[model samples]
Target: MQDADKNGNTNQTDGPEHSALLGRMLKGEKLALAKLVTSVENDAPFVPEIMEEIYPKTGRCYSFGVTGPPGAGKSTLVDKLIARLRAQDKMVGVIAVDPSSPFSGGAVLGDRIRMQRHALDEGVFIRSLGTRGTGGGLSRATGEVLRLFDAFGMDVVIIETVGVGQTELDIVDIADTTLVVLVPESGDTVQTMKAGLMEIADVFIVNKADREGADKMVSDLKGMVELNDCRETDWKVPVLLSQANQDQGVDEIYKELNNHREFLDTHTTEGERKAKIRRRHFLEILGHRFVKKVEMLAREDERFRDYLEEVQQDDANPYEITKTFFQDEEFARKIFGATQTKPS
Candidate 1:
């Protein structure tokens, strides 16, 4: 895929001239917002350079992630949250992750559609992200966008992921605060919660609270939460009720979020959260380096392609070829050239 120019949604331009994009983003230039995000989404070479220029002004925003099963009213809740945040005169950025359609390889992109009322509001910046075939429920660019919004001086950045299924727990690594939403009387709430979503919840919201069993569902969640890890004494995860469409009980939800952020700001939780963020960024960097090294080596090493052709032709057995693929001296040489680090 092609990237945009730094001034025009970030194209394939190559040079220090694009550095102004970062400065313009921090200055709250709207066009710069689109362009800078384009660079991050495409993993353009200019991303690191842009981020380095903007790094000092980063981390001003409180990052919150709202994640749950489909039909749990997460989008509605997020919409309500944005309303509350905006009433306080806060600048907000929302990144909504939509599932991609396998057949079409395009996201429905309905999240932004649901949020159309805010499209005209200058204080609210919202972007829709397709998972991009990641299977992991979030787009690869979600974290990078979070940093971008923070550097742009957003007061709060809320990220909503496609559903809180198993590996989609990747949200925990990226979000400073995560809210897990559920419906009342979903029968399998406990079973689904057992899939690790319960442990990740800083705030448990019973969205669609006007529904028949909302209260009962909230009670059941509280019961399960206590029995599961009641040992935290006062560390209970609050279960708030919200009728997202009607905007009922959203203020209290915001209160809970604020309280959780305050709790996390303490000395102990502060270090742990920062450490996790560091590790998350480190793994991302490592993944980028890994793929780049493999691609560069495969391009430069003739033996690498030769081995593949051999495997296809049955001139080499799987096990023997695997050994050769790794131990090939040229593999080491190309990798070292790409990564600037020696292979073990």
Candidate 2:
């Protein structure tokens, strides 16, 4: 497979198939969308080109992130939220991040099973993504997948993380609003929250409110929110309770989600906050592409392979070798120049 470069040269990384798939996806073909998502998840060679073509269609969908500790009823809460969104005649896309299967490196929890009711709904799209050993409770492909959903004409996209405690703050970077779901047993988590979950929550939910100590958890979170003066914005973080199993108090949570979204629309539209988000996203893309380029080089370039061999055999100091490689003008040319000439 190959595509033409800007300078009339052929690059062996992309072909017509992906472009045809993208065309089908944009025309509302669900199968095409699914195939494109699989390609993104697997880090296909054509991802950069695909994203470049679809970038103009993104930013139309508002994204929400739902994350918390395992067994906190996060899945049920998301299910309920999806229904509410559907009731308003909105097209929804869900990216449920599940723990990876050790053998296949695929999503094992199968969130689609729990969301079976919406399986046949044309307005709803649900996908389960494996964390693939990436930290921050999300697959490395999550950001790109969300963009694909946006370009597919979804009104809203929800990202549900793998429920890893504390370290799941990456959602704040990608989601327009972040919902931190907790149970009454999570009192200890709140008490020791430090700078992690507590800082990232745009809305706090104490799910399974029928359980004991639920009220106290709500009060404690509210008190924490009051004492936390570090927020730069005027939007007050709301703490709500829900028994998602019985469908109680979900409306309040939904209402607050909209309220927060509205706040962001009005306040962060064109400020340093928005600029910071764009900058972070750019840096993340740059870092990911640079890593992929290096990986390809290590596989094909004999000199780079020798460097890896020395590190593997402990015959060279990795830090010194890295500094020397950066100093070599030819090394820089190989990395950046290959972007246009080499297959990914």
Top-lDDT candidate index: 2
**lDDT for each residue of candidate 2 in 1-344, tens digit (9 for 90 to 100):** 22123222223555777888999999999999999887776666677788889987887899998888777887788888899999999999988765533211224435333676886899999887764433222445788889999999999999887564533566545888999999999877777674576568899999989999999999988988888877777889999999988999999999999999889888876466557866877888787767766766676667777778877774678898898888877668777764453422
- Among all windows of 10 consecutive residues in model 1, the one with the lowest summed lDDT is 1-10
Which segments of model 1 are wrong by more than 4 Å?
A: 1-13, 101-113, 133-139, 230-234, 267-272, 299-301, 311-324, 338-344
Tell me the lDDT of model 1 at 341.
32
Q: Report the number of the highest-TM-score candidate.
A: 2
Candidate 2 off by > 4 Å: 1-14, 99-113, 133-139, 164-167, 270-274, 312-315, 338-344
lDDT by residue (62-130, candidate 1, tens digit) is 988888777788888888888888899999988876554331112444433367677679999887666
Count clashing pairs, candidate 1. 4
